[model samples]
Target: MRRKEDVVRGVAAGIAMAATAPYLTLKLLWLTGSHVGARDPKALDSLWTVNLLTFGMDATALALALSFVRPWGRRAPAGLVAFPMWVATGLLGTILVAVPTDALASLVLGPEHRTPDQPHLDDTIADWVFTLVYGGFGVQGLSLMTAFVLYARRRWAGLLRSRIGDLPDSPTRNVQRAFACVAALVALAVAGVRAYWAAGGEVGLPIHWVEQRTRSIATMDAAMAAMAVAATVATLVLVFRIGPGRRLRGPLTVAWLGAGSLFGWGGYQLVAFGTETTVKDLPSATPGLMNLVQAGQFTAGVLVLAVGAMALTERAVQREQPSSRAALSGTEPPRDLAAR
Candidate 1:
C-alpha cells in the first residue's frame, strides 16, 4: 500500500511539472518579442494571460507534491520551503521587474514603437530589479533541484534490497549518472549566465563579442533546454527500469510521461528561441512561436497536475483496497496483529 502511494505521488509530481510547459512557451515568446519589439498588442495580452494561468497551475502542482511528503522525512520540509521560495522569486520577477519594465518602456517610447536598440524609461531600475529577481529564481531552482535529487537518491537506495532488487553498477547507471551531471552543469551554466548578465558583462563572449551579454544568455538558455530534455528522458528511463512493485507501476509511468512532456516543451523552446532570432529575426516570428510555446507550457502544466491528481487518487484507492479485501473476507483479526 505504501508502495502504491509512492507511485501515485511520483506520478503526480511528474504531471505537475509537465503542466508548466505552455506558460513557459508563451513567456518565451513574449521575451523574444520584447527583445525585437515586433509583437502585437493582442499577442502581448495573450502572453500575460498564459503567464497568470501557468502560475496558478504551478501553485496547484506544488501543493499536490507537498501533500505526499511524510511528516518525519527530511525532504518534506525542503519541498515545502522550495515551493514558496519559487513563488516568491516568480512574483518578484513579474511584479518588480517584468511588469514595471514593460510599463515604463511603453510609457516612455509610446506603445506604437519600441525596439531593443532604443533607450526606454526605467532601464537601470528594471535591470537591477531583474538581476535580483533572477538571483532569487536561481536560488529557488537550485534548492528544488537539490531536494529532488536527494529524494530520488534516498528512495532508490531504500529499495535496493527489495524484490525488484538493486540496480547493477553498470553502463546504464553510468549513463544516467552522466545525464544527471549534465543537468547539474546546465543549471550551473544558467546561473552563470544570469550572474554575468546581472554584472553587466558582455554576452556572446567568443562568438559575437559586440552583442550585449544578454545575447550570450540565449546560448546558455539553449544549452539548458537541451540538458533539461536529456535529464527528463534519463530520469524517466531510470525510474521505469528500476522502480519496484506493480502498485507503483502506474504512478511511475505517469511520472515518466509527464517528464517526457516537459522535455519536449523545453526542446521546443530552444528551437523556437533560436528560430526567432536567426530565421524570423524577432517581433516577426516571436509572437507566433511565443503563443505556441505558452500554450505548450500550459498544457504541460495541466498534464503535470493531472499526473499529481492521478497519483493521489491511486494512493487513496490502494489504501482502501486492503481494508475492502479484509472486510470482504470477514477477517476482523486481533487488533494488535491487525495493527502490525
Candidate 2:
C-alpha cells in the first residue's frame, strides 16, 4: 500500500523551517544587544521587546511548517493544529499577496509611500537583513499553506465536500446568526473608516496622523479595510446562507482570510500590550476613537472565527456519525472491513 501524505510537501515544510531560521537568529542577536540593523541610535524605545515578539511569531510558523511534514502532526489533535494554522493563513495570506505587489508598485511608481521615520534599518546590507526576515515570513506563508492544503485534502476528503450554502440544523444557529449579524455591522463600520482614511479624510487625529499621509499608509489602510469588509460580509453570508446561489469558494476564502487577520492581529496586539513588546506602540491616556474601531473589528473577527470553527466541527462530526452508528450496532463501516 502507498504511504499516505505527500513526501514532497514534507520537504517543502523543511524548506520553510529553514527559511525562518535567519529571521529568528537576527532577532536573537538583537535581543542580546546586537544592533546590526538599527538606523536610529536613539530610537524612542528599545527594540528588544519588539524583536522578541516577532521572534515568537516566526517560531510559531516554524513549528507549523514542521507539523505539515511530519507524522506527529497528523497524530496530534486536529483542531489544535488547525486553529493556529488557520490564523496564520489569514494574516500571512494577506501579506503574501500584498508585499510583492507593493514592491512592484514602488518600483513602477518610484516610492510614493511615506516610510516610517523611526525603527528603520540602514538602507544597505542591514536593510537586506530585514528584507530577509520579511521575505522569510512570505515564504513561510506560501509554503505552510501549500503543505496544509495537501495534508488536508489527503487526510479528510469527506469533511471538505460540503458546498458553501448548505445549512444544517444546529443548536447554535440562532446564537450564531445573531452574533454574525452584529459582527457584520461592526465590520462594515470598520470598512467605512478604512475607506475614509484611504480618501484622506481624517475624522479623529492623533499627532501621528500627519506622518501617515503618505500614499503607502493610505493604500495599506484602505486595502486592509476593504479586505476585512469583504471577509466579514462573506462570512455572514455563509453563516446565514443569505439569499444565495453557490457563493462558496470565494466567500468562504474571503471569510477565512479576513477573520484570521482580524482575530490574529487584534488578539496578538491585545496580548502583546501586556508584554513589553507592544507597549511602545500603545496609545497613552484616552483609549481614543480608534479603540472603538479596533473593538468592532475584534468582535467581528471573533464571531466569524466562531462561525468557521463550528462549520468545520459540524462537518467532521457528520463524517463520524455513520461510523459510530455501525460500531454501536456491532457492525463495521464498509471501508473498515475492506481495510482489514
Q: Pick the candidate with the highest lDDT.
A: 2
| TM-scores for all predictions | 0.36, 0.83
lDDT of 1 by residue, 1-340 (tens): 6566566556644553444444344445554554323224554553554445545544543453453354444435533543343333222222323334445656776654436685332342244534443443344333333344334444433222223222233334444445444443443344344344445554433222223234223334343333334334444444345444334434333333333334334343444343433433432333343344434433433333343334334433444566777788998633322211
Candidate 2 lDDT by residue in tens digits, 1-340 = 1254487677778888888888888888777777666655344135456668777878888898888777788777877787888788877876775677677778888865334563222422365775786688888788888788777765654434446655465787887788788878878887888778777876754434544355555665666676678777787788777755573556776777887777766666544432232333533222356566666667778888777777767755655677789899998765622211
Q: Specify the poorest-scoring 10-residue window by lDDT in model 1.
A: 158-167
Supply candidate 2's per-residue lDDT for 39. 56
Candidate 2, which segments miss by more than 4 Å at Cα?
1-5, 41-45, 113-126, 165-167, 242-250, 271-287, 334-340
Candidate 1 clashes: the total is 26
Candidate lDDT scores, in order, read: 0.40, 0.69
